[model samples]
Target: MGVDFSGPEARAALGVVAPFDMELDAELLRWLPDDVDMLMTRTPFVDDVVTVEFAREVADEGVVADGVRSVTAGRAEVVAYACTSGSFVRGRAGQESLLGVMRGAGAGEAVTTSGAIVEALQALGVRRVAVATPYVPTLSHLLDSFLGEYGVSVTGHDGLGLEQRIWEVPYAATAALIRSVDSSEAEAIVVSCTNLPTYDLIAPLEAELGKPIITANQATMWAALRRLGRRPTAPGQALADH
Candidate 1:
């Protein structure tokens, strides 16, 4: 006899439109409840280098609108543009434009990674945050500016200067980076990069560092799930816990 393929039913769904090189689909799913479904799509691939030009190209309104349209058929209640650098490289106006495009393309509710980071910070009542990223200084600075636009101060920051394959960076390296960027003034640590693997690091690092930790994938999933009127499950992660 064939195995029962329909053992469980999904209660709700969230849509995600990610960058071309995103490698964290499984990691994103780990944040969802068993009864919730995630519908994901990716923008066209670009060069391996992570740069301002690369961000601009990947964030083209036409491309993102198309991506959103492709996933809307899944009946997702909310759609998220899950690229931190791409969404913020153009600043707040550009970030808002992406939402408009996604909405124009059929997304009733939309969120971007950078936008979700801000919301996550606000939800946690955090104003001063430390940042660690796998980006060149130039790309990373854009994140600082993006946060500043919302009146959030960066207490400290450090970057690994990585251009590609961010997913391969081990937890030890990321943990060390987080430690290096942390400061007494910082209420939270922000790890910017949807491609970097951070689901397992949020809780332990929070315990050791004595602050909340918000990573790209965590914020994106949290915001999307929140919009769907459901809570994300990441056992000791501060963002999910809220």
Candidate 2:
């Protein structure tokens, strides 16, 4: 008797806990190798507004713990909290606490979008960054403060001031925002917000601006895949290709 293998072998699984409004799973998948699997769960949906208060609600400790637990059953190698503001709203200490919560809830390894952004920046030896986000001014400032905690400087910043439907923002508008904030002092451009799509646009924008670009979802997936000793499938992305 004989048997044949018909499909790609599963090498590993990475669990992702996204915000209720996250619509970029396909984008995340594009970065993954065919052998790796992505298991995803979302925090409970709230009102449609995307605000600081909403980020707080989604980042509640209990919510994070439950979300981590939901994905642990799949035996994922790592669990990632995929909302940038939700993980960074409380700053560095809060980001550490989220990792603790995910670990306590059965994740062997844990990462968060904001935390991954910091790791990616450090990996590239980037110290100064330009920031762009779909959030309002207040939330944008929080991201700046979050990066500052890691000794990274936000040399330039701009926001779209959207209260909801951040995912609906097209790439052209995001590209415009990235260009507007880019400055000579910035070593990289950080596109905040996991729900904002930047997967296909990363390499081209990097060429246009002549600097590295780190987007929330890209960083989250990169940090998680790193735990598996694998690089993402992003061909020309500075952080992923690194």
**Each prediction's Cα lDDT score?**
0.92, 0.91
Candidate 1: worst 10 consecutive residues by lDDT? 6-15
Per-model TM-score versus the true fold: 0.95, 0.96
Candidate 2 residue-wise lDDT, 122-204, digit = tens = 99999999999999888879999999999999999999999888889999999999999999999999999988999989999
Clashing pairs in 2: none
**Total residue pair clashes for candidate 2:** 0
Tens-place lDDT digits, model 1, residues 81-198: 9999999999999999999999999998999999999999999999999999999999998999999999999999999998888899999999999999998999999999999999
lDDT at 5, model 1: 97
**Clashing residue pairs found in predicted model 1:** none
Candidate 1 local distance difference test against the native: 0.92
Candidate 2 regions with alpha-carbon error over 4 angstroms: 1-10
The superposed Cα distance between candidate 2 and the true structure at residue 214, in angstroms, equals 0.5
